[model samples]
Target: MIEIVDAVAWLVDLEVETVRTDAVQSFVKQETVFVEVTTNDGNKGIGYSYTIGTGGTSVLAMLREHLLPRLIGADAALVERVWFDLFASTRATTVGAITSLALAAVDTALWDLRCTRAGEPLWRLAGGFRPKVPLYDTEGGWLHLSTDELVAGARASQAAGWPGVKLKVGKPRLDEDVERLTAVRDAVGAGMDIMVDANQSMTQAEARRRAAAFEPLGLSWFEEPLPADDVAGHEALARGTAIPIAVGESMYSVAQFREYLARGAASIVQVDAARVGGITPWLKVAHTAEAFNVHVCPHFLMELHVSLVAAVPNGRYVEHIPQLRAITHGQMRIEDGHAVAPDTPGIGIDWDFDAIDDRRVA
Candidate 1:
């Protein structure tokens, strides 16, 4: 039996490389909580989860005070069982951000152990549907960028052969958002896809208005126009607009996704593995979205998400937001505008432990 002998958790803070602004908030530092698990036989796996800025200490506390202790002596290979047991143990706090984030760190670590034991990379072990997914650039489309900058960024992505670029919407005025997106659309022309995200900053009425305005621009999707919990609002907006309503990054559970898909509230599902409580449930959400014929374009964590997106049939596009460069050895390889899944055994991120130690706060 590959029993978990030890589990350790810590915190690392990664600074944003550039100023990332969207409709609701500025890009604050990433507060990452990493979990490392070791089996009795000496095999080990690493897993992690993150918050945009706050909640790192809480996630770490949850793991150290509750989750990691339960992991000791548990069968590391039984990934699903471990996930369920841990979730059940934390029933008081189950299905929320802090608990889910803590659970994610532990769950992903177990998956890493499972993949290592199987001697296959996570993409193949998870499903291995495809080794590459087409890329979409989000790094260039911050709401703070001027119209000229947005145009230049979109043009740069187009020149590089990337199929899509996402722009941040929800400006003070409807025309301001329109003006920026119009410039990018004209700059990138008809070949490259243009996606817009409102970051869940607008009300139902405002979203409806923007959807109508953005329809003529030929947008690929309008993401998170309303809060994630506003299912009724999303359903109405989705029904009314021709542009797809993309959502799910802010959601914390599989049930949330089910509600969205069952009601036809969302067209593109942006399941963040970390936010969804790691790969175990993340896969469930993706498969559920598939049943509804919704394509998943997962939000953030590109390194971990690349393998996951490549593993499923209905995986659409991987959002390109580079957040791991400072504490990781290398970047996710982009070949011909598609993000390639790493073939390395276990979760494929090459962590720089030295860098992590330097940045460790807890």
Candidate 2:
């Protein structure tokens, strides 16, 4: 046991080169909440979760005032124990968004510490399921983009050898949504895979309407046309849509995914490592989905997802969003449409702490 440790947290405001918009929100900035823990034996590891722009400081306070006190001088190797300890402490409200989000911050940090001490990369520690993963680009739709900009973004994805791209839908008027998809489809031509995400911005009625309207255009899937929490609505939309129904990303917890699976309401699953309490639960969700014969096309952070997705039989696609490349030491690669995970152990990458943000003792 590398005797228990001390931890620290930092915040970085990562920039989005272009306005990335979807049904529910718009992003021009990404705030990465980074955590680093160091053992008495001089071993250190880094982990991070994104809060985008909300509740990050509140999370920082919770870890310092609550979670970190229990962690110090504890066994560094007891990653799972720590996960459960933190999770159990908050079980009453653990199923809620903030609780899960807080657990995720600790969960990711623990895994990073474990893998670094073991001298293995995160994917390998995560069970070395697959060293590379198939990827789909998420580009070509911002709320304010002109038709040409959207089309060009889609074209860029194809030109870069990406098989598919997700376009933003959920314009207030269904006709506007229809035109956007139509132009993007026509511009990208017949061969590319075009997926649409309403970003959980539409009402069930609106979602159902859009789904029916786009059935003729041959979309790969309709993602979160309604909010993730609306399981019953998702079921209804899933029934109405010609394309597969994809949801996750915003969703937290295995139980939520279990409900989604049991309802048979989702065909394309999007799990995020940082969102579902880190790798441990994320793996459970992937395996759970495997049992149902559903595809796990995990959300962003392709570098971290490749390992988990490879470990399962039903894993499908990794969303390729390159926002973190500037700060992460190892940038992800694409080879014939598959993303090759970095060769280093424990996520095999380093965050440029100085460049992204300054560090502090948590």
Candidate 3:
């Protein structure tokens, strides 16, 4: 059995061209918490988790103070066991962002070690359902863009052969949101699939109203119209409208996803590996969605989610947002509207250590 000898954690800050806005909040910056674990046999694995603009230090603290110490004499291959130990050690923080994100980095690092030991890529090691998965564009759908800019962005994504485009809703007026979606629909035509996300900024009444207005437009799905915790509101909204309600990015555990699925509150499951406590629990959530005959189109981290989505049978779409371009040596392969899983051994990202070091803060 390989024992973890050393574990290190740090923070890296990444910048974007402009602040990315949605219906509820603005993206100030991306702070990624990186973890590297070395095994007794001299094998190493690197893993990371992300935050919008805050809490990276909290995640690092959790890793350094409590979680990393647990790895000292533990079997490196016991990913699930290690994950549970970390979860149990920090039970007070369970169901919260900091605990889940910290566990993600450790669990992911262990999985990376497992895949490396087996000499197999993560997608194949996970299950190998498909080599490639279809992708949809969300980078062009920020809430602050003008009507002209929105239409142009949608057109460009369509021209790039993306099968679908997601637009942000929840403008001050319902008509304004409808008008923007209508413009995009007209520009992209009826054949291209369109989705909308409100980012949990609306009330049940307002979400119902928006769903009614959006029903006739043939949107593929309505994402997070109401708050994520409002299971009753989502169920009511789902029953009232024909559009599929998508949720899960804000949820921190598989149990939360179970509540949404069992109640038929959300039709589309957007499970994020990082948010769900990494790939171990992520696989549980994905298979659970499969049992209910629902599709999984996970949120961000396209570089990693492409592999997870491609590994499961019910996997649907990968959101096209490359957040690691500046720190990774390679890019996700996209051809004919699908993102191909990387064949390299271990987790796909080849971290550029020098660049990451240049930006490291902790």
Candidate 4:
């Protein structure tokens, strides 16, 4: 057993260039909490979690006060055991954001350490289903953009050889959403896949109405039309439309994912690693989706998701959002329309500590 020696964490705030607005909220900035763990055997691994703007300090506090201390003398290779310990430790806040984010930092670090020790990339270590996965662009489609801007963005994505482009929905009138989607579809034609996201802004009845309206457009999927916790609502929405329902970035537990999958609520799973505890449980959730014959198309963190999506057979697409380029040393490789996984021995994130240090807030 490789005994753990010490753990450390810090916060870095990354500012966005554009106003990223959706139906529910706007992304003002990214408050990322980074973690590093060292083993007595002279090995170290890095991990991180993210917030859109607030609550990052709370996650860091959870790590410092509750999670980090427990790792001082434990076996670093026992990632799953340590994860379970952390989950049980936070029984009061089980399956919530702060607890899951804190646990993600520790759990991901252990997986990175394990992969480093074995000298294998995370994709190969996980399953090695494919080295590359298809790409879809979400950066071009914000709710604030006009119909002309949406059309231009979709054309650019299509010209760039990306097979899919996602648009933000949830305007005051359903006709407005339909008009924008229709224009983009007419511009890009039938070959290009157009997905739409509501960002959890609508109720079940509203979502069902929009789903019925959107079915004629031949959209690839309708994302987060209803709240993330509304599994029964999602099941009803799924039954109402021919369009597939994609969800899971907001879900925090494997049991929640199981609930979504077992009831046939979601056709595509958008599980985020940081939100689901870390790589350990993320893989479990991916396999569960595979059992249901659903595709695992994770939300954001494309740098890390490249390897993870490529790791499993059921993995489908990686949402393209460039939030980490300023702090990371290298970019995830993109060839034609698919994203290539990083060959780095650990989790494949190459952080620029100088950049992070300059941006560190707490």
Candidate 5:
């Protein structure tokens, strides 16, 4: 048995490369919390989780004080058992962001160890349904971009052979949103898929109204139209509109995803590995969505999500929002229009520790 011998956690703040804006929030710096686990046999694995701007320190504290300690001397091979034990130990904080984020750090590290020891890439070890998934560019779709800019970005993505581009919605007036989407549709023609995200800034009534207005544009999906907890609202909205309701980026547990699926609220699941407590529950959410016949297009963490989307049969497009280029040694590879999963062993991310050490804030 490979016994866990040591664990360490730290914080790194990566500044956003561009001004990322949506209806509700602006892109702030990424507060990345990384955890490294070393086994008694001298093998090491690394995992990480992050917050948009806040709570990184809290996640780090949770790992340093509560989660990491529990990993010591535990069997590294039993990743799922370790996950459950940690969840049980942190029962009081179960199903919340801080605990979930903290748990993700440890859980992903264990997965890294498992994949490395097995001599398999994470995508193959996790599921191996495919080695590549289609990509959609979100970097040029910020809500702040003008219609001309949006059109230009969409045209650029089309020129690059990308299948889709996501645009941000939630303007003060519904006509403005329609006008922007109309221009992109007209510019990109009918071949390129167009998606829109409201970032959970709309009321059910507003969402319904916009969904009705945007339906004629032939959008791929409407993401985070309303807040995440409003299952009933989402259900009503889904029934009232032809556009697919995409959610799960804000959710923190598999139970939450199950609730959304059971109620038929969400059609596309955008489950974030970090937000859902790492690869363990992330897979559970994907399989759950699959059981419901829903497709998953995860939010952010393209570096990790590329492998995961490649791992599952029901996986769909991966949103392209590059935030890790400043700290990671390599970037996610895109071929033709799809993001390719890393063929390397472990989590597939080549961490540039020197850059991480330079960015360390806590």
Candidate 6:
């Protein structure tokens, strides 16, 4: 039995080489709270908490003051049970962002340790049914870009062999949003899949209005058109339009995700292993989506998600945003617009302790 010996959290700031802008937020740097767990046997596992802007500090506090103590001396092998206990112990506070983000850090670290001990990659440890997951590009079509830029970005993704490209929507003025969507679709032609994300910027009425306009474009899916918590709003949009609705990054638990699925609120379900409270619940959520016959397209952490998606029978597509490319050593591979998971043991990442040096807080 591998008992957890110690744990620590670090704040990592990865310099963003590109100007990432959208209706919801702007980013000059990507900051994450990374968790490092050590076992009594001298093995170490790494995990991270998602959310780039402000919540990272609170996540760090929760991990330091709450989760790490509960986990120490616990068997790392039984990750699922521990995850359940930890989540249940916080019944009063377990259903929201802080709990999920903190739980994700601890849960992900346990999975990392489990796979490392087994001497196999996470995807293989879980199950290696599929080796490659289809890809899509997201960062290029910033909302601040001009219409010509949008077209250029879409065409570039197509020329590079990607099956799909996602652009941000929710321009304060709805007509400008329509023009940009039309320009990108026309430039990319009918061969490629064009998707738009509103980033939860619009009200229910505005989202419905915009979805109506994009319906004729044959968009693959309209992502996060309404606030994630607005289940009735999303259901209304889904019923009102032919375009499938996609959401998950902001959602924290299977119970929360279940609300959307059970209500027929979302057609495309996105589960980020990092954001959904670790590999245990993440797998459960994926299977849950499967039960509903809904396609599962994970949000990010592609290098890690590829193995997960490949393992799941209902796995659809893995989001391929180049956010981690600039900092990580030997990032995931993109070929003909799809990515194949690495066969190497564990999560297939060797944390560059150097790049993440500054974010370390006692």
Name the candidate that leads on lDDT: 5
- The Cα local distance difference test for each model comes to 0.94, 0.78, 0.92, 0.92, 0.94, 0.82
Comparing 1 and 5 on lDDT, the stronger one = 5
The residue ranges of model 5 lying beyond 4 angstroms of the native Cα positions read none
Question: Which runs in model 1 stand beyond 4 Å of their true positions?
Answer: none
TM-scores, each model vs. reference: 0.99, 0.93, 0.99, 0.99, 0.99, 0.95
For model 1, which pairs clash? none
Models ranked on lDDT: 5, 1, 4, 3, 6, 2
lDDT of 2 by residue, 281-307 (tens): 998888888899998998876767776
lDDT of 4 by residue, 335-356 (tens): 9999999887999888888999
Candidate 5, backbone clash total: 0
Q: What are the candidates' C-alpha RMSDs?
A: 0.6, 2.1, 0.9, 0.8, 0.7, 1.6
Clash count (model 4, backbone only): 0
Position 246, candidate 2: lDDT: 95
Q: Tell me how far the alpha carbon of residue 13 in candidate 5 is from the true structure, in angstroms, after superposition.
A: 0.6
Q: After superposition, how far is residue 75 of candidate 1 from its true place, in Å?
A: 0.3
Per-residue lDDT over 1-362 for candidate 3, one digit per residue giving the tens place of the 0 to 100 score: 89899998899998764557998888877899988999999999888889989888989999999999988988998888888888989988889989999999988888888898899999999999999999999888899999898899899988999999999999999999999999999999998989999999999999999999998899999999988899999999999999999999999999999999999998999988888889999999999999999999999889899999999999999999888889889889999989999998998888889999999988
Error of 3 at 2 (Å): 1.1
Q: What is candidate 3's TM-score against the reference? A: 0.99
